[model samples]
Target: MNAPQTIIGQSPALSAALDHLSALATIDRPVLVIGERGTGKELGAERLHFLSSRWSEQFIKVNCGAITESLLESELFGHEAGAFTGATKRHIGRFERADGGSLFLDELGTMSLRLQEKLLRLIEYGEFERVGGSSTLKVDVRIIAATNADLRGMANNGQFRWDLLDRLTFDVVRLPPLRERPGDIEELAQHFAVRMSSDLGWSLFPGFTDEAMETLKGCRWPGNVRELKNAVERSLFRWGRDDAAVDEVVVDPFANFAGPFGGDSTAEDLADVSDSPERLSTGLPPRRDWPIDFQQCVTEYAKAILLEALEEASQQQKVAAELLGLSYDQLRGLMRKHDLRTRPPRRVSNPRK
Candidate 1:
């Protein structure tokens, strides 16, 4: 995160993005950040806020998809005491909390039909009412939302509100996934490793050895940067000796990565002249095309966890549990019921060429 608000890389696409971010900072309009999960939508929001005039105020965040439909309204618009079950205390929702500041609505596409209507009005009028209260309260908050889910696509699909979508985005910054920025993976890996080591204790990571780094870059990383971070953490745990150095980082992401694949990771898919004949040798099955094995329920759960992690490492079992304040072991056990796999991962290449 300390690597300057604008991300850095030698690639023309990445450099272009960095240049764009610098210019985009001067505008105060609502900024919508779009990308695959773990691509740092929130980081983009932080950069937007810090660059704006409202830097002096609060930057509140709310994940619309995290809350149940029943509670989402109250969480965003506040609610009078007794608004619903366990509503014993009067609550001020994210909007009011972010009054005079910026409110970051993550996963904004998950907002339900009813909630979307209320949100649209708030954006238009800068006012809203607590769920159980009739008195409309006004806020002077700036809106900055980020989502991996395609809100515009959802709106067109009728799952999201079109009017709300337009209101939420006047300026959108779409970030390419890590696969597009292979040039920056080293920097990102180091950043996440240092941060993870600090929180979990350096002892948690023995290293991301050169071999591990090769494996990591080869991974499809369906979960994106956050998944890469988790992979680094897991790699240390999987292979690290008790006395190993924390910075001796080695990663093999393809050893176990699994999620929906959208590119030509398979050699057959890319028979072009540039295709490399080498494979990552994850020891695991070809995840994207692998057959399902559900003979046991525990295996089922494992498969689900692996899939979830591959697609949304930022919200897979571990991250989801943390967001809900639950123990990871419990969730890990639950993951056993979903038919997850434990094969090795294969690395992928930058597809821009």
Candidate 2:
């Protein structure tokens, strides 16, 4: 079967993952996909569905983490009219909708024990009852479960059902994080850059310099592919001109860094230090430095911290403030003082003919 276009990578790890998915697609058994966030678990699920015999049927995805426990029950199992306080009509659940096809349960680890029991029944007997209905319904669905959490560990601790794990583990596919596949970084970065450029309707797409590419390949991406995609898009968004070549790709070093101390220094920080006068002729700091502007230095430091927090929170000011241990007002005050407002770069207009 052909691979899905959404899965991008030339590394050996990615190839192995695709092979596993393809091999298991021919069989009709439950599959458990293990990987870190942004590691393309959903893509793996999709590939399995499209490559299987039930490709023509619906491929339904339900995020167990996004839905609350109370709602999850009704979401997975259909509800009869007047079943609960909010139920006004009969509802068809994901299992029914995905009957004779595939169902991708993302963040499966977050599912409650009660829901797990119901899912276990579905997998073991192909039968389930609605939240409020008395009749049992059967679905011929191929289950594909994905999670970043350790399922075996959870089972050992009694948080997850071992029976469910056993059923879903008929075939397992583990995806490697981006850090382990360094060779694919450039390819992925370029892919995201081109895609983002097209999305913005720019006449010309900017090309990354050698230095920028090196910077991208060197940094540790904790959030995996999702983080890398966001960083590339943000860099392109901040690229001021369409005609000029992109000299450097801007990546936030502290994007994944949390806790009291900031993560590692970013490429931008190294550049700042390299250009500072504090460095002597030997590229080393002078033992006795000249007097510096204390206020200016404090302002710059605060602005850098603020920017890092904002990047870590994906530009969410409230979350950024929480990360910095400051109130919303205080965060806003710092942003205004440093003129560190976060806004998308204006599109570069085409020159008149």
Candidate 3:
């Protein structure tokens, strides 16, 4: 099997983490990899496994943060037949299945306290019993746990067990955020652009001018690689004013950051009007035809945008208004009308470009 070529990154932090992973690839100890979501902690774990002596064995990935408490235990430790009402058959747990292989647990911080104890026990003794079975089974599986959340903070706050953390802390690997490693942005962009072109039949080299790339770089990507991929896809499909030239792709990633997330739209969710071809939220959208004057509509819309910007800017009103391109007075008036007059200064400094 060939190695994956999709993930292109060579930043300092990534290089250092790779160097450490390369060094510890064959150790088979519990590894704790930490990074923001979409920083590819799972990819790092795979790199470790594939580069190690266990390359020929299985590499299982589990999202500890995703599964619910009850389902999680059953998921980790294969349940015995009739372990609970839904257990119709005996199943092999991830640990047993990955014996002599690797088990990558993504978002380890979300595991419940009871599940954490079970995980600690599994790491300590290399053993675990089925959810309902009394017999303990031993397996030689390497454990690689990761989290985007602050596990250290969780441990400090007593949300996470000190002993459990200690057991999982044999080797620590930290991956830098997309914002931190500026050099890798271009490389990753090219890589993802090509992937987009191949997978979605979009332009191979994105229509983003050098100016556009700078905006991409300036953003604080809350969703990281996953968000970038989505943005690229949307640019190909939904961007432009329906007059995109062959080489002129006008994907305003800055605009994607608009309405609520990246900009100071007065509406907490301008995404209802976002160019995306889907609904922004689950609930019914606000009525477009309010039986009122246009001024009221703009004010109402501005207020919503302002509320959303508060979340992005930590409740700073001035920053929110500026993002909306509104004058301070105008913002204040709208806020007063909406009963959101209280606000801190807008935090926008001069644009980077």
lDDT of each: 0.64, 0.78, 0.69
Between prediction 2 and prediction 3, which has the larger TM-score?
2
TM-score of each: 0.65, 0.73, 0.70
User: How good is model 1 by TM-score?
Assistant: 0.65
Query: Candidate 1's residue-wise lDDT over 1-353, tens digit each?
Result: 13225453466655665556556767766778888887778877877777777777888888887999877888788889887888898998988888877889899888889888888898898888998899988899889888888776788889999887887777788877888888777777767666667666554544565644644555557778778778677655554454664432333334223332212123321222112223211223334544644233324333443454434333344443343233343333334424343334334432111
Ranking by lDDT: 2, 3, 1
Write candidate 3's Cα lDDT for 1-353 as tens digits: 45633346778877887888788896868889888888888888988889888888988888887889888788788999988998899988888889998889998888888888888898888888998999989999988889888877999998999998888888898877877777887676666666665666544444455644654555556677766656556555554332342222223345334344334444433333332423222233367765766545655565555676555555654554455554343444445445674455456654211
| RMSD (Å) of each candidate, 1 decimal | 12.7, 11.9, 10.6
As a TM-score, model 3 comes out at: 0.70
Model 2 per-residue lDDT tens digits across residues 21-82: 99999999999999999999999999999999989888999999999998999888889998
Q: Which pairs clash in the backbone of model 2? A: none
Q: What is the alpha-carbon lDDT for the whole of candidate 2?
A: 0.78
Off by over 4 Å in 3: 1-6, 202-207, 239-353
Sort by TM-score, top down from the best: 2, 3, 1
- How many clashes does each candidate structure show, in the order listed? 35, 0, 12
**lDDT score for candidate 1 against the true structure:** 0.64
